[model samples]
Target: MMRASVLLISCVLAVAGCSREPAAPEAPAAVQADPAAVAAELDALLAEWHESELKANPIFATALGDLRYNDQLPDMFSASYRAEQEARERDFLARVQGLDRNALSGQHRLSYDIFIADRESSLAGNRFPAWMLPVNQFGNYGSFMAQLGSGQGLQPFKEVRHYDDFLARIARFPVLNDSAIANMREGIAAGVVQPVPVVEKAIPQFGAHAVDDVEQSVFWGPIRNMPADFPEAERERLTAAYREAIANTLVPAYAKMRDFLRDEYLPKARTGVGQMHLPDGKAWYAHNVRVNTTTDLTPEEIHQFGLEEVARILAEMNAVREQVGFKGDLPAFFEHLGTDDQFYFKTEEEALQAYRDVQQKINPRLEQLFDIFPKADYEVRPVEAFRAASEAGASYQSPSPDGSRPGVFYLNTHNLRAQPNFLVETLSIHEASPGHHFQISIQQEVESLPAFRRFGGYTAYSEGWALYAESLGKEMGLFTDPYQWYGRLSDEQLRAMRLVVDTGLHYYGWDRQQAIDYMLANSSMAESDVIAEVERYIVIPGQALAYKVGQRVIRELRNEAEAELGEKFDVRAFHRQVLVDGALPMGVLQTKIREWIAAEKAKAGA
Candidate 1:
């Protein structure tokens, strides 16, 4: 919920005195606003947006269920394409300006603000040509195409035509790669190359898909597991086309791109970890910080805030360490958790089974806390073997809007040592249960919400809510085991430490290894996990700051309510108010909570 505009005591006094003196003859009332008209305008704008956007980024459109442009892949790295996307955003902003926001209700107004702000932010970002460096190892179109063509990802596999269309899409890989190479060359000239580490890490990932025979590539997933209902003739044709497309196009393209990065791009890549280190680094990072955090807080301010938060969470962690009968200090306990086989699963299957077990165990207990829950069912699945090492310990993929698929909680079992028994409860809560599952699925099911707000999200609000749910593990009665409770503390500490480490590396000149060492020393983290996390920070700066900072504000808001309302506070109602209007800025969330508190107090007075 967007916060109500702040009300001053002087404004209240002014209104009270004005009400007393209101004896003048009333002028003719202005035209009454129609909610339906406002909605019609919104609908028109949304359709126009979908059309304009799909025409510009057809791949993204297909990913999001818009199939009209299914066969046409945009030259995403083209200069003209970038300019056109910016123009589209400006037009959307202008078109929506004609609508009377005050005529709409609260939710519609919020949708308007979020949409406008996002576009305006995108426009602000247009100054930087991120399109020029589109195909990094982290998530390049090269790899994504394989995933799409593999018949197992987002591309529909129900129909054989779907399979044929995907193969046609895969055939365009070399054109896309040529465009990407041209774009990166431009980046080199502009001094806008990605960090050396990102490029270095990406080379092997590309090589993984670049195989001796494309016919036997990961993209063969569909060919291997064709729908049993398909006619044998159709299936055979698809399998042959898929094999030819993969072997001829995808495999060669991946090898070409991988070799280019290794032999051409890697040596030219800048050693700097930050956008600030690039030619226009300072401006680039500033725009990114604002966009990612959705606040105007400077990197400098966030850095300082993170430092303070690290100090605070450190004290809490130390207190937990002492309670657990650790003979050594907090650092020793961290090392113990990192290295001990006793804390780890014996195999990858065991680790995945543990998460599935958590799914069954927590569902019944969740009802005790949430009066409202997402109707979408979710299942626990292991990370695909290809990307597991690079992935987070556990991550969630939200359900399709139509509910054909349940939300998926992907657990990474790449290195089983990183999958600790102690942290399972906290991980489940953060990735599933009252964490992402609650916040995301609820927003999607909100019928009154506009399409964008229902589908789109802010990292701070989304990740912050998940971290906050981790704190609720004890409240919901799941952290009964001391080791599990310690796991909760450890995970909480990791987020708290992210506040420090992310800001440290990006803003304060801390080395990559420095960030990794700090996390390993402070929390029970495996070195592999620490390396992946530090690299994640290097590529995507300021994102790690969201979880803890957002969580802190939310907790402060709740504490204020509990204190002010005393015995009258309703936890469920408070959560409903936070979630019901969808995600909002931290400032907006604060305002909404204050409004709820005042309304509750007024009701008590009556």
Candidate 2:
């Protein structure tokens, strides 16, 4: 999943202002006459639309390499701001619709469809009161703000202006915290509060930022590592400023949020894990399923799909057990995989080195399957200490569009046993080389696409591609070890289980323990990992459903293409078609692939 940093920033900035950023000095004049002029007009509109987004959420802007609004923080959660965002989306939708779609072809038509769909989805979401229940275990603004203030997240702290910009941004945290508190209270009044367990998890996250000594805080990171090249006078000035900001403003803001969560919100938080517990929750969950998966598949349909997938994968697991001559059933094999010291690393460095080894093995073979590669580089790093325990086993952060920052695949080494050596190759593929890093970096570097298509994403397309990438192990010649092959199945099983447990928790009214039990019974995941994953589903309903749903569509598309095209099918070209336009909704992706298949067939015949 994409980290909460960009989303949190957008949510916060929604309430800050409604004005568009100042127009570019040589902005295109409004379209007047010709059909060709319509294309230019659409391009100009999208550029303006993207600029407005950056202006509203400066942190998102920074992540995309647009430094124009780095110092700003918008009040994104207020009712007035939401109304403005809604209005702005409506305006953009109207302008996009007014374009001459009949006059456009190829990429221009695809852009038009995607732009319209994106705006409509945004407008449709206003029906749900997501603003009221903002803070949750997985992605509360409190945690995201701390990450930004720590100077290691998207907010830059390099030059003096970068430092000053962050100081300006951090100064606004108290206001954002006040808004979050107010929103939570409103959630309580409206019967839209988070689950009790999820809210409790966030309390500790807030306290991590609310430190007693400013110097000991995560926010003290930039100051501790200040550049030696800085002038002594400027260094002293920033030091004093940072100390004051952390001690007085940032720390107090976090304490207020922590205290509110503990004292006020926690008491009123709903005990039920499902969204069905909230007012209009049933419909809300259905909407979220549609949004995340970009499909009309209902929870019941998805639940059944999960059941079928789990059974199929379990049968494969049994095959692996028999191959290894394990003298036991499937559950016993799971136990062995989880407990055997041979499958685990003894130290953090060992685990890190194992992942590095996987990278070396896979890098050389990537060109055989994919012709287009991302220019932006990537690296492997340990998950930051503060959030490591609660974080997923691995996640990827995309590279900066300008290539200043390499995409990082953060491995969680909080528990060495959970970082099993068997899982290293699959995890590396999913989070780095053929997964997020490849998809996202290619999107950012594709200058032909509009800004939204480049940076924007459909959850299903992105996550599904990663899951599909994991399935390429044998073909790529890396999963030669039986344990490594089992690792791929285990990873696939996790996505399959997400289909079952996420829907179970939200749709079937299964409690947290019920979700946890289902995961434990179905997969070989460590108990701590299972608990974290379950809590993640509880807090972020419908998101987990995207992985399997997306992967299924992409894999199906590839199979159909290979069958129809026969010897004419080029895996390299097939991959390029899917990724060249960045992430599309599954339907759009299918259309694009079908078109490519037809064109390939025509070429072969000619």
Candidate 3:
């Protein structure tokens, strides 16, 4: 029951920049300067921002599972929406910039930095026409909302009014779908259309949503699963309304969008792989890099890091190949490992079942490594069929703050081949066990952190920890099988490749073919998986860099703690220190851990 909120992942960041060491403390403010005033201002601003943003992107409101503005669909792809976002960001930035940072203490400083960094990064990204490249086969807004209106995905069917709101929302779909089409058209002319394969994959998704009858739609989940306690009259009314909404609004809107994309948009869509072919392509990518990484590291730096990591991982894979008695060069061995039918699940259901099995296997082991655990339970489910193709191999959705729902680890069985048996261990570790499931749910459940810190996150810090967790397979006693060990290497190698391919396409001027070729030649990835991954890098720049970069930092921090504290160091304590603070910019995270390490050292001395 997590709210339908936007998942705003952003740029890499540098370690903490130096500030003049706390100048001599000033006189204490009278009565501690009324914390209430600051609290009130922040709450008001946050509420206003949410309302305005929801008004501008009603789909966002709906996604948060908020129905207050369900009937409306903002012109998100329009110039007006972009302009308004700019103004809002600038206004908020100016207001916060004027805040007395020095006067703030403890959690207040964290709030200020989180708010400022988020808005500043967003504003920095404004130059990019991200809106134009709107309709992807993945988790883009257009398709997401279609599911919402169809009454299937996140939309609820509790009461008669809820049914009416669902209908009202679907009625607004034509406008939203039209906007997506228009934006895609604009992208086509600008040569920023998604890759051909990705777009082709998108056609069916749009086509399916464009079904002619509401009764045949996925939105009928409510009707099929209606609560038994509901009165007979209410049930009938809801069933009819749901059908009417999907028929009148949902089907027509989808058909129009599907037709436009297939007939009008796709034909004109450019075949270029990178944004560099688009208007302001170079500048657009640069902005994306800055925003996503939260750092000034040029694409060149990330690309080079990727190259080095790939080499390092290849050596590790060679070690595994040696251990497993494979007789061939590394690349040849990789192909064997990737294509072997025994390595893959025979059916999608089998693939999903395998993941559930891992959850059972992992939970017992997790107790050995950690003192803390999330109160929220988690489930292993397949990613919805509609969006699975373009989605990541696997992902975890955090639970609601109030614990109304459990965390969900969605395994993308869209391509069963992608969910090979070897990858199950790595994917489970990353998406469930100590990776996203643990980190996110723990953060959400933390009562000590601010609401923003508990719920807000950074891709590098969050994803970095997840990727790092995959490296702990042996430490957790699960990488006993050499093939599973190879799977761990494969997953790491993929992340390492992201570091290279993403930067190659965005910064180093490598063509799409070059990036694809590099992945094919280097890793044990299927072509379908490789294509989806590279396209992900293209659309979401710098995100690929966070995995390896963040993991490296965490690994290094652990090493430092172990070296510094020797036998006194505790892995569980180290992990708790990292997670308890919630997600921070990597730099802040480093500082906090170092402070903990020093404190432990001091305590040992005492």
Q: Highest TM-score, which number?
A: 2
lDDT per residue, candidate 3, 1-606, as tens digits? 112111222332222424323346657873444566776566566556656666776655554556787666666677777788789889977987665555555556656666777786776666667787777776566567755644445565666676677667666667767777787777777666776655676777777776666556777766787778888988888888777777777778777877876777777766766767677888877766654454566777887888888899899999999988888989889778778899999998898888889889998898777888888778887777667767778777766555555678887788877777988888899988788889888987887665556666777778888998898888889989988988998999998888888877776767777988999998888888888888777766666777777788899999999999999999999999988878877666777788889999999999
After superposition, candidate 2 runs with Cα above 4 Å error: 3-33
Over all chains combined, what TM-score does candidate 2 have? 0.94
Residues 9-36, model 1: lDDT tens digits: 1111211232123334446786655888
lDDT of each: 0.75, 0.83, 0.74
* TM-score rank order: 2, 1, 3
TM-score, every prediction: 0.91, 0.94, 0.90
* 223-273: candidate 2 lDDT, tens digit per residue: 998888889999999999999999999889888988999998899989898
- Model 2 sits at a Cα RMSD from the real structure of 6.2
- Of models 1 and 3, which has the larger TM-score? 1
By lDDT rank, best first, the candidates go: 2, 1, 3
The ten-residue window of minimal lDDT in model 3 covers: 1-10
Model 1: how far is 479 from its true place, Å?
A: 1.3
Instruction: Give the C-alpha miss distance for residue 64 in model 3, angstroms.
Output: 5.6
List runs of model 3 lying over 4 Å from the truth. 1-75, 149-152, 185-195
Candidate 2 lDDT: 0.83
